[model samples]
Target chain A: MRKKGSYRIKDIAIMSGVSTGTVDRIIHNRGKVSEEARIKVEEVLKKVDYRPNIVASALASKKTYKFVMLIPAFSKGDYWEIVNQGIERAEEELSGYHIEIERVFFDQYDKDSFDKQMEILEGMEFHGIVIATLFKDSVLRFTTRLDKMQIPYVLIDAFIENTHCLAYYGTNSFNSGYIAAKLMYQQIGPDDKLAVFRFIRKGDSCSTQVLKREEGFRTYLDENHFRGTIYPVHIHADDNEGNRNILDSFFLLHGDVKAGIIFNSRVHVLGDYFKARKKKDFKLIGYDILDENVAYLNNGLVTHLIAQRPEVQGVNCVRDLFRHLILKEKVKKMNFMPIDILIKENISYYNNYI
Target chain B: MRKKGSYRIKDIAIMSGVSTGTVDRIIHNRGKVSEEARIKVEEVLKKVDYRPNIVASALASKKTYKFVMLIPAFSKGDYWEIVNQGIERAEEELSGYHIEIERVFFDQYDKDSFDKQMEILEGMEFHGIVIATLFKDSVLRFTTRLDKMQIPYVLIDAFIENTHCLAYYGTNSFNSGYIAAKLMYQQIGPDDKLAVFRFIRKGDSCSTQVLKREEGFRTYLDENHFRGTIYPVHIHADDNEGNRNILDSFFLLHGDVKAGIIFNSRVHVLGDYFKARKKKDFKLIGYDILDENVAYLNNGLVTHLIAQRPEVQGVNCVRDLFRHLILKEKVKKMNFMPIDILIKENISYYNNYI
Candidate 1:
């Protein structure tokens, strides 16, 4: 038995017959020590058992870094709000280190908005940037500028593979798509017809997440050997008229479709479409937990939601940025967020931040 | 916008009329250029946009580190097993860095066993340590020695104050207790007398999670403004004879007590007690998802079992260790695992790894 807090580095040094400076240098990894001395020092220190006081270390350290987040603004009932909450929580926790978070939100629905935001960002100086890869052209241009400026940045929610970015942290789109497909595959028998509804905007910027998800969903069905007629329909997500026209034409053409899967955030329209038509038995699965989607889930219209921890993804983007710039640390090239399967029974327990 | 991946540091240097060596030195912080040169270089670099390739950086960097885990050994169930799973996952993810994990598991039922483990650990070398602080005396000695040695460690599952640790990641015990109390509180009305059982082991190491849970459960009653008499009983968790004797006498003495709560993992014995008597409808709440407890929960004997993400905690412990050791990253000192409320209807959905 030993008294609490009785151990000290000086004691280890004294017992080992080593200079305190040598011990300090070894602890801090300050170089220039003989191999024999280094081994002897480490051995004696291990024998005594040493642990650093982290609180004192934190307080004594004067390192501070700024992490900036540039992403889509949180609209009413949008998923980005959840992501903002996660970012706020991370910011509060990291406040101890004097790490500052500067958030800049742009409209995902508009390309000019991204360019406008980029123009503003070009004039400012930041240590690191965490941006959602929403508008590819603007992102590439901004990230290219960031690269030239030697400012480290991480991509969140979506990634652009060809460009040089510090790191990427978001959902593994393919795995999540596969998980969703598995769920649907289990739910429906081999004889049932399946439809994948992708709400694509006409002349809109491409979203890599949607493409990856569609590819993954298709791959699952192919791999699982499902013997059913599969149909895919692409409609403008933001245009209700476009969605209705395409859906109407498709349903009229193929009235035998028993189940539908929406590959992206516009699943709410499917819910609205199905609910209005009173098509109760058509099994449906989609992405996210929008209020409209939750309403559909509660009403038993939506069978499942393949949720990406968008909030944690947002916060981690900032955290990773700080790690790269402030700590001068090596950032991971790709970080896949967990794919949370949210059902009506379990949605209430889902972490509010996510 | 700009051609994809066409930009590089050489282009920026060419555009700026500065030597590539000067630009590379500036980016890597070699510190030879004048202030005017640095500002001029930064301006041109920003105009053309140069991004460092992370793939190149990851390939070029050479670093290796050691992470050690000190936790309780897997006992009758998967309490520590889930955590080990998390650790192994992190190890796999970090395998490319030449990083290593050295795990030393100690007996939870014996303080002397833990002390011996600590003694053995004191003789070893590690860059970081992740400990499940189950015993006070052993942990205090271990942590103090670690502090003296200037080795940073993180606390998981259980935490102690007035000591140095890099970070703590576990569930909020008091809040969990409050949740337990809430669960049991809902089952019984104010007229009923409640009992809290602490399945103790005379001289063995017990967790503060138990005590905090008890406190939180009690506080729930106080906060909810309920009127109920609460009785706490402590008995050896494994002593069936002693437990039966104590319960028989206690029931005989306090016949009015209709509901009970186990602030620890001894819910199985209570289930066994009830099964022996063939008792029905006495409100019960316990902890974890052990096989015995799961049987009880499924049999309608246990009303609510509060579950922390045991597997996630285990996985995060390793990830945290790696982040601290390899990346030189600072981890959160106290990461409160999500306080998940598990019900029969939602348990399956909540079981996925985070």
Candidate 2:
């Protein structure tokens, strides 16, 4: 009889009086085995109560795994560049384990570019995929295809619910907004008017992530019975003139608006505008610690900047995929990164991770 | 002739017309080798420009490493308990790689207990050590003997300067204090009176960590030209009546003290004191997110709690030692953990790491 917890396939085979291949076939339910051999193997399995060590099994298999990453092109800015750096670090660390990562980038602002990349990915064979789901419709369409092909994929940066994604590593946009509102509420009076800035590409809808944040911000204000009027204005991300025009009009209409909150990392634009105009009275809260935003914070133009650790998100995406695909480990569906609050004092330490 | 990067000791042995062991002996200067073989091996090394991969070398050596952890007993409180949990996680993860970790805990409040533990450790043979240096004099003595034995060690929770430690994974107490002061300064006016509380056992001197924090806090106030009167108080951690009496005397001497800063996790004592007196006007800031402190923060009694990420520190201490001893990697001397500012809103997310 096989010893409990010490029964390898060979041991099972010996106990069953069958070939090792027959034991393997019986265990994995793959290939054909004689009924008598199968019955004996089953009996041995029940007697031993053998549990496989998936990690050891994976290491011993000696099979190479290919992971494909579909992310926004690094040409966008330091944001994507930082994420790419994290992915590269994970790739290098896992290289000795016979895993290869292939990166495919698409223009973040263009649907057609994303579609083109998705088409390329459809023809490629990979064990798993890691994607930055910026374009919702495109990602949903591609994820459907990925599901049909039985290819597991993890999402980063933006999370969409009711999707077939194996897991997601990103921020909870609504909660981040709620946190921003809480910080803002602490510094502002009940009667003070507030301005909200949302940056989007021309003719493009504001991303679901941004919209959720705005909604959460509004929810907090409404729930707390905040008496201040909230004036929200959207400006094109690349259009300097449009940004200036929107801000100027909003300030002119509500001159008493003492504090402003930006929904995204485009807070630098507002910081620069405030500095040029010499508006020292306005308190600003923004998201992310991009260089420009931090500079603005240092200069006292931006009062508080909420940080989402993009690098940690990137690293976890690769690690989660590796665990699921190679080690047969079950992965959590959602991994929400901590919302880091960075003022001028603690930003230096936060910068060390990237 | 060996290639530039692929020169192994086997190749060196072949070139020197000796056994690989002889080549290894020549390379490491560990064992006696014939003069001719040493000279030939040196010549082959110079010719090939061989650079050894320490990780691969350690793996191939098949050495089992035993690491000893010296820290305060977990029975002290949640702080040490959290740290022990982190160490356990690392031990479990590293067990597969033939690494064994033995924990030795001492009484945090008693120097003699620490010394006794050190005496036991001196009689043991361990490859590496991870220590929480609670008692400075005792730790210095043990570390001196450890250096003589050539056993590498990492420090956690508290860092001592100019020590023969492989690395330190902990908070920079002074900087955390400075950050705490900065946050306090923003909320209180320059004319306001501020109270500083340091809790300890009766007749116990405040730890170097706590004193450093107090120094940093004073530095910020002096540098910023804060016009506030600073009230410093110390209370016995377990003596509730003594804590109340001390606080009452401080407040009666300077009733204008509108804000208070506690230098350690025992801020909960002050929180309980404030709640019992129904003092709503005082703004309180403290260090750590122990259960009582978080409850106070949630109830709006504690305004801010600076988190040193003890669990992360624990995990990193073990990981750094593993890299230094087993992988032969050069670890940086000081690893200052991020000072996490926890308000009630973000505490849920921060709680997920442990």
Candidate maximizing lDDT: 2
Residue-level lDDT of model 1, residues B91-164, one tens digit each, is 76655455668889886666777788888887787888888877766677788888999998888876688778
Candidate 1, lDDT over the whole model: 0.74
- lDDT string, candidate 2, A213-251, tens digits: 888888888888899788877777578887888889878
Q: List ranges where model 2 is wrong by over 4 Å.
A: A1-65, A97-100, A119-124, A240-258, A274-282, A351-354, B1-66, B97-100, B119-124, B241-258, B274-282, B351-354
**DockQ for all candidate structures vs. native:** 0.03, 0.26
Model 1 chain A: ten consecutive residues of lowest lDDT? A1-10
Fnat, one value per model? 0.02, 0.29
lDDT of 1 by residue, A62-90 (tens): 66566778877877888888778778867
lDDT of 2 at A267: 90
- Docking band of candidate 2: acceptable
